[model samples]
Target: MKNIIEELFYGNIDTQARGFKKDSYLQKQIMIMSNSEEILTERLKGDDKKTFLSFVNASGIVLGESELDSFIVGFRLGARFIYDTFVDNITPYDDFLKEVNNEG
Candidate 1:
């Protein structure tokens, strides 16, 4: 889990941080927030897609277009990583439904 989160953070940040000066605020914030599992988990929990969009839209008000765009790309990559991790850890949907049906 930690490896996946780290990979997601560094992978996106490496690409997104290009052309910006080293240690820029945007890059710094990405590093801090991405390293935080709690923040990522909360951002990725129930209704995550909607939550991500809401975050982007809200942040856009204060962020420039390029920064907002970078954020969108990073958010998408993070969301996918979180989703894949979740899918890999959980039972298959069909199997879960079958178990629930049997129990009722």
Candidate 2:
């Protein structure tokens, strides 16, 4: 199975084709993060990790910091659903998780 970084880039093609600006700082940061697992993992710590996972769960939007609690709940449920529905049926979750979390 592909790692989350690969998955994000794979999914980026459509957005790029739709004329989404690819030169923004956030875009560059995402590319850099996608290529460097250590940097990505380091930035995604504690609340950042929770916010990120929540962003992913909500398809990339957060109303406010206060909404993070609800977002986290949904993120956990969504993660479990994905793990059971997809991860278990394909690659082991641990393997993919390890690959994404690895410092190197």
User: lDDT for every model?
Assistant: 0.72, 0.68
Name the best candidate (by TM-score). Answer: 1
Task: Encode model 1's per-residue lDDT on 2-70: one tens digit a residue.
Answer: 586688877743654547568999888877866764566556767885677578667767677777788
**Clashes in predicted model 1:** 0
68 Cα displacement, candidate 2 (Å): 0.8
Angstrom error of the Cα, residue 2, model 1: value is 22
* TM-score, candidate number 2: 0.24
Summing lDDT over every window of 10 consecutive residues in candidate 2, give the lowest-scoring window. Answer: 12-21
Which pairs clash inside model 2? none
Q: After superposition, how far is residue 20 of candidate 2 from its true place, in Å?
A: 21
TM-score of each: 0.26, 0.24
Give a tens-digit lDDT track for model 2, residues 1-104. Answer: 76867877888434225443769887888777566755655678898887766665575444455468776899799999988987676653457666778966
> What is the model-wide C-alpha lDDT for candidate 2?
0.68
